[model samples]
Target: MKPPVLLTRDKFRESVFARDNHLCVLCGAPADDAHHIIERRLFQAPQEKGGYFVDNGASVCEPCHLRCEQTVVSCEEVRDACGIKRIVLPEHLYADQPYTKWGDPILANGQRIRGELFFDESVQKVLKQGKVLDLYTDLIRFPRTYHLPWSPGMNDDDKMMQSLAAFEGEEVVITTKWDGRNTTIYPDGRLHARSPDGRPHHSQAMVKSEAARFSFDIPPGWRVCGEDLYAKHSIAYDNLPSFFLGFQIWNERNECLSWDDTLEWFELLEINPVDVIWRGTFDEKTIRALPLPNPEGWEGYVLRLARSFSYGDYPRAVGKYVRADHNKLGVVHNWRTAKVTPNQLAEKS
Candidate 1:
């Protein structure tokens, strides 16, 4: 057999990007990087192992690049996107692999970013050590509640209030904002707590395992965003319907679902959603005077437009009003270090 040609990393990336038309197949955004479907570090020889070939790469945007690394955007999906068949690895490539170069920096959007490097002793030990990638950087967050008072002289408050005012008299959906970690569950069942790194925290261990139990067949680019209520944070709940309560769902186009649609899908998945506190036309007076559920344990409520909106329109579409002193006085102990406490669940017939 003749020896195949080898390509440098730069040449490999360029060839992969060129093959995909310089566009992210996952989201159709401007492609700035090419990613390996299999771990590049697993390749003992680029020429012999075929690691540097375009068939093993996918052109992606920076955000989608992170998704590829996280496995939320599956290797199969990347292969389908690139119009290639799955790259079957030889057993020798991964079997009995040595921990050679884990936690190495990843190239994305033409820059090196923090890799998926974590301790082996923790719950994150399941993660492989070699060829790490950074956490997703563009994950959406719950918009700040405009009805609640922003600190005085806060630069963005005026603009936020203006956006909120535009929705006056529009129908809105108000849901219980549980005092827990804001978590995102991908179609592949990966859970990420809202944080700078978006890693599944130790406190969220139980919920992460539970979420992974469900086979979510959502569309390739869709995501389920919700609150993981496994551990008590600001308020210790006496009863929790489920450890996870979905609030919003984002489609492949990055557009959020309407409240009615969100509820229906949550039902379809057998996943409980946050309690709907109220649903009616926006009336500041009615909203302010409404009594909160469980005045002692409830965190507060979130107000959002009943209709769907694009990802970028979040600032104008959602808001929340937390109880007084919730941030400072509500949380008395660190949920991570404290002993694992189980919240009571309502009995099902």
Candidate 2:
């Protein structure tokens, strides 16, 4: 067997970082090294055609890279241990590659600009002592608008209120915004948290039971996005009916269904849907005057156009309005803390 060819070029490292958005594909932390799924040595042989290709590479942090080198766990195990959904390489990197598992392209947003790179010289030095080296850059992901707590003096809030006024008469659906970790259930039964890294989120038995009962109802390539209220966040839902409350039913293309369709599917699956606060034209004054949905004071409300619409591969018709005092209770300490038994949390009840 010929020795595997190693990919030591800086450009190759940069490409790997860019593909992973500069975070550890397994843990969602800053990536310090690039790991080869197939050992680089295996490709060194003169007859081997598979050299250092982005198709088999993953941007990983130092700890994850060390775990990979230890050979004590499988790649999937390492990924789960680190809370990763899956190693997603940006589409552009694998455009001509034969691989099928490509990640959503990182689009430019206000939070992070696409194509920007953040290099850490110290991390690079640490990686040099390890088997996998040559990592130097970190790529950032595009940002999406998230629900924010209302602030009195913030000029942005004033601007947002003015902008929302335009939709005052447009029909919209207002769903009670729960204060909990955002989660998603894919058509394939995979559950993940809503984060830049798509970390795996564990649910309680009841939550899993409901998901299993409705798994068959989920169309292929569609996803159920919701809030995991298994644990209390800053807002405690002592009167909550269930641990999970689904809000959106999205299609394979990532476009959300209309309010009616979302409710229909939830009813069919017998899943608890987020409380509908209101259904009418966008009424900023009415929304502002509405009381919190729960005792903790509802986090806010989500406004979704009765009809579905997309903006450059994103859902643009949806927006959220939060109470200024929403975060007054302080931050939720336990966001994505998974159980010791990886699969036990979701065991069939």
RMSD of each: 16.4, 16.5
Per candidate, the number of residue pairs that clash is: 2, 11
lDDT of each: 0.63, 0.54
User: Model 2 over residues 236-346: C-alpha lDDT tens digits?
Assistant: 555566677888787654456877898899888777888887888767677667765663546777777786643222213566776667656765445456232211123
Candidate 2: list runs displaced more than 4 Å. Answer: 1-103, 106-143, 146-162, 165-169, 201-206, 293-297, 311-315, 334-349
Residue pairs clashing, model 1: 116-133, 145-320
Clashes of 2: 11
lDDT of 2 at 172: 82
TM-score of 1: 0.56
TM-score of each: 0.56, 0.51
